[model samples]
Target: MPRPPTMEDVARAAGVSRSTVSRVFQNGGERVSADATVRIHEAAKRLGYVHNLVASGLALRRGRQLGLLIRDATNPAYGHLHAEMNRAVQGVDRQLISVTASRHDYGTAEVEGLNRLIGQRVAGVFVGTGVTAAEDLVETVTATPMMIVGRPNDHPQIESVSYDERTHGRLMADAIAAAGHRRIAVLTAPLLYSRVFDLRMRSLAERCGELGLTTIPVDLLPVEHGVARALDVAREEALSCIVCPVDFVALDLLRAAVARGVRIPEDVSTVGFDGLGDGLDLLGLATVRLPVAEVAREAVTRMEALLVATQEDAEGPPPPGGDQGGVDATARARHLVIPGRFLPGRTLSSAPEHLRT
Candidate 1:
């Protein structure tokens, strides 16, 4: 069997220094001319010199790898975002290491696992859900660089990227009120796994108050049992429309409503978030389409910047508290709110003439 070509072999073949070969492979050869890059590639190809990323990372002390921590990988909304994040990371020539933290069991075990990733020297981390203000984990994550997605809270050191669920909730309430539906009910899963859902509910409640509309809260069984519970709620409340937090829940609601002979949009309107799937297109459920791809791209970019900033701080004086400390007053001023757009679909419309004012 042939032995793998080494960096020294490539350097000898190209008549360049070993450092030059390393720089070329790492894409950091700013001083090396384009001709040098071409020669290095040719020599490496001829000699079968494959660059080992793990070895390179160890040498530079900066792993070109990212850690992605998520909860509820089964949730379509999260699944979509995860795929987008993976693609974006790969696009930038970085590798992703994914970890699933249990939704119901986020304890010291999870924190220890996350710390292990940091110890392994991941460039940065992107947390999808199930991670919150754990002091130890927060300290470790902030000490390095991290970004959180789909959660509202911000940390002194971590950057958070999520859609304005308040805006989405307000939109849902306004639409239902405009349709002359005064008595509406919102069906959602447990609050623990539904922080975004809770935010939307609060926003909707505020809007309902302003519009002089009435709202009923319906706690659906766990998401896994949503279809049956939502159906039961529709029957009991005679709800004119049901606002759901996700497309899957909305799909379940639609099914239950239909089973009970409830007319969609005509007798009862439905609205949900995270527009995903052509199947939903056929159902025509009104929804707020989250910018999943954009969110992933932005989260990864922010993570990269945070990692770079962390490294710079380690090498030099900590950036001014106001400027570099993610917790500083200046950083607070940098908080960003990206809004979501409401997509009007066939599932929502004016309430029946009798139901309207």
Candidate 2:
């Protein structure tokens, strides 16, 4: 392959010096004339020049980059986190870099992704939803500051900004009890897959038990046979309500139930966590709303603090490889757990007389 185009090529093509090209790409094109900025961009595009933040940052020995490791950015649940965090990063005049975990090779892919960001020399990282699987990668990630967003974790090595899952679960359970849903089907993934799911399930099951509700467990399978399994449990157990741990699964079960001619809240009520999907208002689906914006803002604020601390400690020995002293002596770890909001939609209602037994 021909040698890739360089800043000098862009400068030459754009009728500007190499220093001008560096100023344009490296420093947000400030001080450079608008016409020159446009010309440089057009030239770079024509020359197939790809700006490498990692290389530039390493050369400068300084970069304001915050890494984001999201499980699936396309998922509607994380839309707010992505948008709000982007705004936060811009507010600080910093750059946001993202990596997605491979669904097929989660363990190895997550490790590779984390190392990729570290290699780029980011100031810190704001771990997005489902990245908690990197709990095992703690040792490898500790050199840079980290804050867990979109989910709760007890890892002492990293700060966490998340909503209280237990509280949301209890709120859902209370709503079910108030609505007279005695026999309910709880649809969820296995406990090992998610800490948030595990916490929500544990709280919901306990609270439902206390409320004298009969919970029919509907565990999801790998191939998503859980959707069909949900329909079976809803009918076989004569469940008056379907309480799903997350909205997507609940939506799936609801669609399947509707196809089977089940009247929602008339024949069976439904509730799900996470206010991610749409049509919930139209369907009157009761659910728990995650505090997305709060988590994003906090994640950014915490990262800034860590960055400052990292700079002050630059002369000290390198950060321990493990999660040890994740929070520097100058900054304390922030374990923020904002409460979840419960929307009392029409999906929750009195149990049918037939299922009361």
Candidate 3:
């Protein structure tokens, strides 16, 4: 009928500080003396004490609990990222709490979700949405150990681990050019809506220009989900290929083409990014698959390092959650770009002879 034995009981029995007991259990007695660790374990066994990692994490605030802010969980890419991040977090014996923001609300939903995570006093936060601007996220985090994930970040004070979208764009462009498509339409949202898509489109356009291919930009409005306007532009311009920034857009275009009874590859070729969607192989949609698992692992690794630095800061002169300036040069903000491989699907083929020129 008695309450379960707690860490305090074990600490008192072992004649050690509460923080020392915490370090012994939380970090496998990394810095605790051997005698203290043995005594703590002996006391825990005698008292039938078990460490509650969840309660410990919450109490520490800056412990092994991290936050993630993702957008559009329904989207295959984000879904894959969320799953991989969870796996990564669990692998390191840490806990992750996530918040989802509206994909269409631009920065408002994302900002609010980010603040919610900050209010939890998590050790650090990972921002995985592309809708919010890097500058806005940086300003919002202030001194929090925040890092950008699955989205491009170039701010000197913000760290990031993102897909190599530029490489993805160039790969798609090269595939389209090799198919002999002289003119292609790029379906993408404006920079304000999604910075990743904007960068991919810009890189695609630049590469297309280098390869002497004519590029036509088809602005995708959020109000319209279908790519009917893009199809019309392709038909009117006699474009031989249409490249989509994401697989979802490509799927929409394919559905639109099917409704219009337009033949794929024969009438025109199409390609998209993010090969994470289901049935991609069955559909044979040419695209690039972002390294979601790798990005997640790397982001978690960077976060762990940041948490360590933050802990050290708390023990030292500077306050915990201090600004970037307090951290050493090597521990300062850095960007890591991971590249993805190309999937040569059936959607991309030789341009129709009539539209080759």
Candidate 4:
């Protein structure tokens, strides 16, 4: 039997993509360039291909969908939070769909995700930090309920559930300073800036300054090369301690220091934020533990409230398997703040008798 042509055939012939072909066919939606549209048709003719969305049409409908937007889905901190929410939504028999994007894709993905969610008529959306610009989401969630999880915004259209990041920074700085460290390095996550990042840095620096300790910021090299960079920073700066914004970065620095013949706490000490399980227990890392489970529970309760309120106007939810967004009228502008707990570990200690700098 002869094979029937598909969208992939047309896309390849037109020098475009399967999605571009889809955009052309779904003229009710995305606008493909006129040139590309013309080429799509020409290729369809040459290849004897007919675009059929029949399979997509026959997919099962998920009537009660919730949307979640987060970055670095592989990160354990966000992973635990996402898992709790997923379980809760399922317990109530609703499906949660999520969209995970990189920090670079934050702007376009949030807006696009929201548009897709609204079109799918999801009951509500739960947005994680770094997903998109907060104000954009404030305006986007008018028709559906939206709970901004792990992110904060001033706009009255949305509610935010957040950790008290200010306190988290102060705790780390206080612990390091109290240990009598004279000079320290803040190993930050690659090079991304956000409100949370800025807040943490400012608080820690301010506290360290108060203690007459010198606090310096250094861009953490990616994991593969991070240890070497960390060792260089430590020896060059004569640093008494290395403070990491996240535990994973802290671990990398520790491994690097040990390889360079530096003794943990005996010569130099280390501290990090986010005391995620297993890793922290194994490393005995002195860190600040975020209340992820609390944050997740709050987000679920708030978003579910909004979803129930929008049931009349909302349509069947987005089909599950991925992330989504929705509009909610019942959601009110509110901010929730939670504090972090500090964990002491063997890695922390007093400053070396004679600091280098």
Candidate 5:
């Protein structure tokens, strides 16, 4: 077997200094004279010289790779966002390295993994979800560019891009109220898994106050196979409408309601958030379609800006609290509330005549 060609062999064959070869590969051939670049290419082709980016990045003290840290890829919400984020990263000409931390048991190991990406010198990071305790991660990646998605409250240093859960919640409340739903029950997961749901809760409460609607608070429902429990609660409370945090839950409710001979839109309307793909239509569910694509695009944009800032500050003073700036103020002062449109499917309608009267 023949030994692989090295940079020195290419340099010698091209009749150019090793430094010139390095510069040509490192900073694109356009940086070098066109004649010299042609010579290098010819030599490289003849000698089978492939650029070792790992070694090259080590020599330059920088890696051009970006990290995408997500909670669970299986979650439809994150899955959609991840695809969009992948496309956005490619569109911006950056490579992405993905890591998933278990939603069930996210611990310090996951944090260490994120830090490991930095040790490998990733250019930037996009945190999707499931990272509990971000204070350390935020500090470690202070000099690295990063963006956090779907979290409302901003970290001191990490930039966050998310849909306004509060606005979405308020909208749901208003829609139900407009349809004359007096007794509304909200079914969702525990607070830990329901940050957005919490916001929605607050907004719903506020909106209900304005509309003189009464909201019933029920125990948090398990996301996986909680439809039965939700259905039981709906029946017990005689809810006029049930606002679910996820489409799956709404779908389950529809099934449960059908089994119990409950007429949708006529007996009890249902609304769900996070408009996923098809099949929801077949169930005739009403939902607020989240702007997943747009949210992912904006998150990537924020990540790019943070990366640029990190690179620019590489030689400058220590990053302020090692946190990404701009995101905190913007997130707090004015949440990027992307409005969700109500998909008034066959599931929601005005309350029954008896209830209205």
Candidate 6:
């Protein structure tokens, strides 16, 4: 077999020293001249040289890897979040170690996953899963820096970049009202199941109350079975709409309606959060297109800033007024809520005259 190309080979081809090539790749190209950086990259591409990030971290014996704990990898929302976070981490030239957990359990698997990442000596962890409670996650990671991502979190001690579910819920409710849905059925789940979903339902119901609209609460336990019951309620009570906490649930309801020969938007309107699934327009499902990519990008950016601040604090105070990389780990926690826009599909429209009271 032929010997593989190495950074030394790349340096010789780019007319730079080996150390310069090392600094350019490992330090995110900071401090290196743009021309030199470009030459180094082009030369490496020509030679088919790939950086061995894992080996570099091993040689340094320091945490050069970031960890991500996400829930239900199969779920489209989390799946998209995982892809976006990977892109952001790669942009900074760091390796990402990801862990997945099912939502059915009581977060034991998630806690163990966190420990595994900590055991790998990761510098920081991004908790993007809605499966674990914020308090439990906070308690588990005492040594490693942890940040909440893509989930609702308000712990005074934890910082998070999450979707603005409250605003999303309100926006959805306004849309329903505008469509002449005076009475609706809201599918809900226990808070322990998913705080994100709970917040969505609560905000939608609250906003509906403010609008003087009637809301029928339907418990969605054991999702498949609950969705069937919710459909029944929508039909029996002559509800004008059924609001789902997530797109998957809304899809389930739409499928069930089809099985029962029920017409969507004509018999009863339907709406959901998280516009991630394909064929949404074909299915004519109304939903909110969540800012998954935006949240993922911001979360990784925050994680990078946090890592820099931690390093500075350990190396001694920065010279007075020195930049802390736009993040202060010692400061009180900060929460950022990014909003999503609504998709007015064929599923939600004016209720039938006989059903609209």
Angstrom error at residue 129, model 5: 0.8
Per residue, candidate 6 scores C-alpha lDDT tens digits across 10-106 of: 8999999999888765554546675676577667656767554333321233457899988887888999999999998898889899988886776
Alpha-carbon deviation at 44 in model 1, angstroms: 43
What's the C-alpha lDDT at position 154 in model 6? 86
- Over 218-270, each residue of candidate 2 has an lDDT whose tens digit, in order, gives 77655257767776788787888887778777777778777888777787888
Q: Cα deviation in Å at residue 292, candidate 6?
A: 0.8
Those runs of model 2 whose alpha carbons end farther than 4 Å from true positions after fitting are: 1-61, 103-105, 131-134, 222-224, 315-331
The C-alpha stretches of model 5 lying farther than 4 A from their native spots are 1-61, 106-113, 130-143, 223-226, 316-337
On residues 34-95, what C-alpha lDDT tens digit does candidate 3 reach at each position?
Answer: 56765776576567665543323322345577899999999998999999999999999989
Better of 4 and 6 by TM-score: 6
lDDT of 4 by residue, 208-246 (tens): 888788877776656547556665787798988877777
Q: Is candidate 4 or candidate 6 better by lDDT?
A: 6
Q: What is the C-alpha lDDT of each candidate?
A: 0.68, 0.72, 0.81, 0.68, 0.66, 0.81
Instruction: Evaluate model 5: give its TM-score.
Output: 0.72
Superior candidate under lDDT, 3 versus 4: 3
| Model 2 poorest 10 in a row by lDDT | 322-331
Which residue pairs of candidate 6 clash?
Answer: none
Tens-digit per-residue lDDT, 101-168, candidate 5: 77665455556456555544466677767445556555444234566776565565556778777777
Score candidate 3 by TM-score against the native: 0.79
TM-score of 2: 0.76
Which candidate would rank higher by lDDT, 1 or 6?
A: 6
